[model samples]
Target chain A: MIKSLVSITGVALVCAALLAGVRYQTAPHIRANREAATWAVAFQLAGGPFPTNNVTLPLANLRIGGTRLDTVSTPGYGGSIEMLVALDRGSIGGVKVTRHEETPGLGDFIEGEWMNQFEQMQPMEVDTISGATITSLAIKRALQSHLRTALAETAPEGPPG
Target chain B: MTFRQAAIERNPAWVQLLGLCPLLAVSNSVVNALGLAFASTFVMAGSALIISLLRTLIPHDVRLPCFMMVIATFTTCAVMLLEAYTFDLYLSIALFVQIIVTNCMILGRLEAFAARQPPRAALADALGTSCGFAIALLVLGSVREIIGAGSLGAGLDSLFGPDAADWGIDFTDEGGGMLVALLPPGAFILAGLLLGLGRGIHEQRQARAHLRETEG
Candidate 1:
């Protein structure tokens, strides 16, 4: 009994040490990669790179021609679809699906060129994907609703025309 | 088990049908398949090594927990490496990679072979099994990518560096391929056909050997 306890403990300790070493070496690179990906989309949405060192997510006030970058989450076919939507001048400047649990191959269309339909559009008028109608409609609804609220709050003159 | 038997005859993906979840899910593209193959191979071999080295020390009753811990550690390592280096590719297949620890193939090898074998033999079995799985993944990935996307190595740049951006052959115009081939039903159909083909070849080889023996 004593030997078994000691052996398991030893294995656990060794495994933990090995993982800690790997994490220490790779953590910085992972962080940098994530930051780079997010910022690349941010720059693309703003139409140009702008300086903002400490911007938070889901509600980033990107000081670039009145662009409000916010994260939106809505129920998708498989699970929640979390997207980073940039609203510029009451229209979507750019949209990026940061996380989702939709069915692969079908619902994953949102991650590809299908998302481009939402760009530069306020009401998000686009046809739903053939097999992924629910996911597509969910994204359309979320973006349009968010845009309505955002426009209403900013303009203080009710919903947009 | 011999490398030949482990890698070809009693293969994990083909013969045992283990780890089919990631196999079918990530095999939609060659780059994704290779990425997963590399990660699975690393985790399997790494865990096998650690388990074999400590096999005698681990109590039989508590071996399962020990193996789980070891496998999880290696899987985590693979995840970190992929996220840091192949960020884009990793993002697409991140879910599959995270679940590598639960892959029955890895655990099966650990329990059936690694636990009892010496370090060298255990490592060999792990490598052989992983290679077999990789071959399955590559074949399925290639077929799916070709018929589904009309391209091979379509995302090479994501797995390799930027220099490999144009490495994939474009057999058709963009978005002109059969969409169903990239879907789950495609994976299932192709996998079933490939398995049947493998078994047919194996049976033919055995029959030929038996016929030669009788004639001699």
Candidate 2:
């Protein structure tokens, strides 16, 4: 009993220490990678380069080129999907799922060309992908509700650049 | 076991039917298969080597825990490295990689082979087993990608560098292919056919050997 306990304890301690070391070394790089991917999508949605090349995240409402970009999270097949929705002149300029826990082969269609169906279309007139009904409905519902409030605010005049 | 036997004759994924969950999940694309294969290779070899070296110190009663810790540690390390270096590939297959610790193939090898072998022998087994698993994944991935997506290596850029974006070959125009081949059920169908093919080959080889013996 003593030997088993000691062996497990020693093994656990060593593995934990090893993982800590690896985490310390890779944490910064992982953070940078995620930030870069998010920014890449953000820039793509906004239609061009930001005024400043050195801008970092926490962009505060994420407005670019008169388009309002919102990070919306809605319940998907497996869990909540975080999407970057670009609202441009009452139409969807672009849509990108920044994060999702949906099943890979089933619900991943949202991140592919299937999402192009929403591009330049009125938010409320979108149809969900056939196989990925739950995920698509979640994204569509979120966008419609979000648009209801957003369009009302910007209806008086076009969104400010 | 010899490397040849481990890799082919008694293949982990094919013969043992171990690690089928991740195999089917990530084998949808060639790039995804290669990414998982690379990570699995690193984790299997690393954990096997560590376990063999510490086998004597590990008590029989607690050997399972020790093996689990080693395998989990290597899996975490693989994930970190992939995230830091090949973040694109990591993003595409993050869930699969994180679950490598639960892959019975690794734990099975550690228990049945590594715990009783020398470090060098254990490393050889690890490499051979990894190769076997990689072969199964690559075969399933290639067939699925080609028939299902109408392309081969379509997303090679994610695994290889940006320069490899054009490495893929598209058989159909406008990216049209049999969509069912890329779906979850497609994995099972392709895997089953491939297993049958493998079994046929094995039986053929054995029959020929038996014929030679009988004639002799």
- Residue pairs with backbone atoms closer than 3 Å in model 2 (clashes): none
| TM-score of candidate 2 against the unseen true structure | 0.81
How would you encode candidate 1's per-residue C-alpha lDDT over B68-185 as one tens digit per residue? 9999999999999999889988888888999999899999999999999999999999999999999999999999999999999987999889999999998987555888879999
> Where does model 1 sit among the CAPRI classes?
medium
Candidate 1 lDDT over residue span A48-136, tens digit each: 78775667655444456777777788999999998878886778878888778898768988889888888745445788888888998
lDDT of 2 by residue, A40-117 (tens): 888788887676465555443567768987777789999988877788787787888887888877898888887777
The native-contact fraction of candidate 2 is 0.95
